[model samples]
Target: MPFRPPPGRAAPDPRLDPYRERAGALFDQGEQIGVVYLRIDTFWRQTGGHLWWRRWSEPSEQVQGYIEFNGGGFDDFYQDAGTMVAEIGDWGHGRFPYRGEALQVRWLDDEESRQVRVSTFGLDDLQA
Candidate 1:
């Protein structure tokens, strides 16, 4: 069954729903499942932006990826990261390829400051 938020609580970002099942399977296998928070900001030329990410379960494991902004914008900036992590868990069992590897990715839009809070869990972190 799909997940639902508690009464009076805000719903989760719909973009992440697709990966819940996959993440659950990983959890059952005793894999380390976590979330990745990404902060993105486009450059003046709109060519690309800085993409910084870190695993929620491991604070010291932080990395950056390249973001090339073409003509169109992204439906969700963190979608790629989420998908990458899911695939890694499914195929590599938490071991990611050299190209793109991460936990369930969520975008951070903090205009006030560049600082980002590393709190929050992914699908696997939820108790069934």
Candidate 2:
């Protein structure tokens, strides 16, 4: 049997699920505000792992856009306290943009937001 996509969008691949690739595409070379989930977990394992993150102490209200990751600093995938930006876009029709790569080794900084851009990052579609 052939798998069908939801409503108006195509289906995502099961073998390779790219996470944050889509969000990067929305960003332009200008000052723009967006929202991204300060994830509590990334690169988790079945038995044991090291990418465990902690939530923020001072909770903030969830608005249309603008999610901060002020969890001090993290070198690994544990993004509990650190902030991540969500590019303002329509996350609908079973299709959401995200980064496929781990988004590491930043070199150049985003001019507008002053956020560092991942030198070798890729994107993918998120299907729910």
Clashes of 2: 13
TM-score of 2: 0.18
For candidate 1, give the lDDT of residue 69: 21
**Candidate 2 structure quality by residue, lDDT tens digits, 43-101:** 21223223443222233212121132234322223332123333222232222233452
Stretch of 10 with least lDDT, candidate 1: 54-63
Candidate 1: pairs in clash: none
By summed lDDT, the worst window of 10 consecutive residues in model 2 runs over 119-128
Error of 2 at 34 (Å): 2.7
Model 2, stretches more than 4 Å misplaced? 1-20, 24-33, 37-66, 69-90, 94-128
Q: Per-residue alpha-carbon lDDT of model 1 for 20-119, expressed as tens digits?
A: 3221211212343332333321111112223432112211111223222223322223223333444435433433232344332223334211222222
Q: List lDDT for all candidates, in order.
A: 0.28, 0.25
